[model samples]
Structure formats: C-alpha cells, structure tokens
Target: MNEFQRISPQQAQALRQQGAVIVDIRDPQSFAAGHIQGSRHLDNHSLHDFIRNADLDAPLIVSCYHGNSSQGAAAYLVGQGFSQVYSLDGGFELWRATYPDDTAQSPAE
Candidate 1:
C-alpha cells in the first residue's frame, strides 16, 4: 500500500496476537520503561537495519507517545515498502491503559 492506516488499541491488539511487527518510536528511556510486549524499539540507529530485514508484506504497527508522531512514522514505513502499515490511534498511552497485562519492560539497548 502507498499509505498507512490508523488503528485503535483493540485493533492493534488483535494484529499483535496474529504476529504483526510492532515498533515503538519513543525515546529509549520511555521505551525501556514499558511498551507492548514483543514490540521492538526503533530509533534512528536501528532504522536502516530494521527496514532492510523486515518482511514488507507482513502487518506492521508503529506507535509513539500519544499517537501523533506514529502517523508520520507509519507513513514513512509505508513509503519504505511496508505493505500493511498501521499507526496506533491512542499510541502507547492507550495501549498501556487498555491492556496493561500485555506490556513488557526491559533495559534500553
């Protein structure tokens, strides 16, 4: 697709269960604190490797602090040849509130 779609937390959760690749674009500290389980922390340093190795046809979800930034990131991923790109509507804040149990924490790497 040439564009990305916006999805609610519920929709994102479903996609997650189905093995969608979820990437968080927040700062390292914030991302290390908590994020969707199995989500990868994508930053400038990792962007190139990520895009190079990702499965373009697989569903991909982009998330940011409150959702706004994710829209732009999602669009960029779509432009990079990701066929199914989605931006989380309410972002990490909503996901944390909606599915607290589905989140994970780790040291920033």
Candidate 2:
C-alpha cells in the first residue's frame, strides 16, 4: 500500500505468529535490555543491510519505545518497497506490558 497501518499489541502478536518480520528501532541499549522476542534491531548501521536482504513483499512490523516513532519507521519501510507494513501501536512498552512472557533480553539469535 501507499502507507503503513497502525496495529495494537494484540494485532502485532498475531502478525508475529504469521511470520511477519518485526524490527525494533529503539536504541541498542534499550533494545538489549528488553524487546519482543524474535525481533531484529534496526538502526542506521543495519538498516541498509536489512532492507537489501529483506523480502520486499513480506509483512513488516516496525516498533519503537512508544507507538509514535514506529509509524514513521513503518512508512519508511513501505517507501523502501515493503508491501505489508505495520507500526506497532503503543510500541515496545505496550507490547511488554501486554505480553510480559513474550519478551527477550539481549537480542535475538
């Protein structure tokens, strides 16, 4: 689509189960401290590589500390050619609060 869609934490979880590529745009330290399990950390350094190798048509979920920043990130991903892009509403904080058991520390394997 032309823009990214906003989704609640529950919606994000559902998308995760369906194999969406979830990317966390938060700072490295905060991301390392805690984040959604299976999410990849994406910053300036990794953004290019991630997009270069990513499947442009796959569902992509962008997340941040709060829901606000994710929207812009998601939009950027869409502009980069991602077909189905979603911005996690309430972001990591809400996801953490909603699914406490679904979080992981120190990044994903």
Measured by lDDT, the strongest candidate is 1
Show pairs that collide, candidate 2: none
Candidate 1 positional error at 90, Å: 0.7
lDDT of candidate 2 over 2-63, digit per residue (tens)? 79999999998998899998999999999999999999999999999999999998888999
Error of 1 at 101 (Å): 0.8
lDDT of 1 by residue, 45-80 (tens): 999999999999999999999999999999999889
Model 1 TM-score relative to the real fold? 0.96
Clash number for candidate 2: 0
Candidate 1 lDDT for residue 89: 96
Off by over 4 Å in 1: none
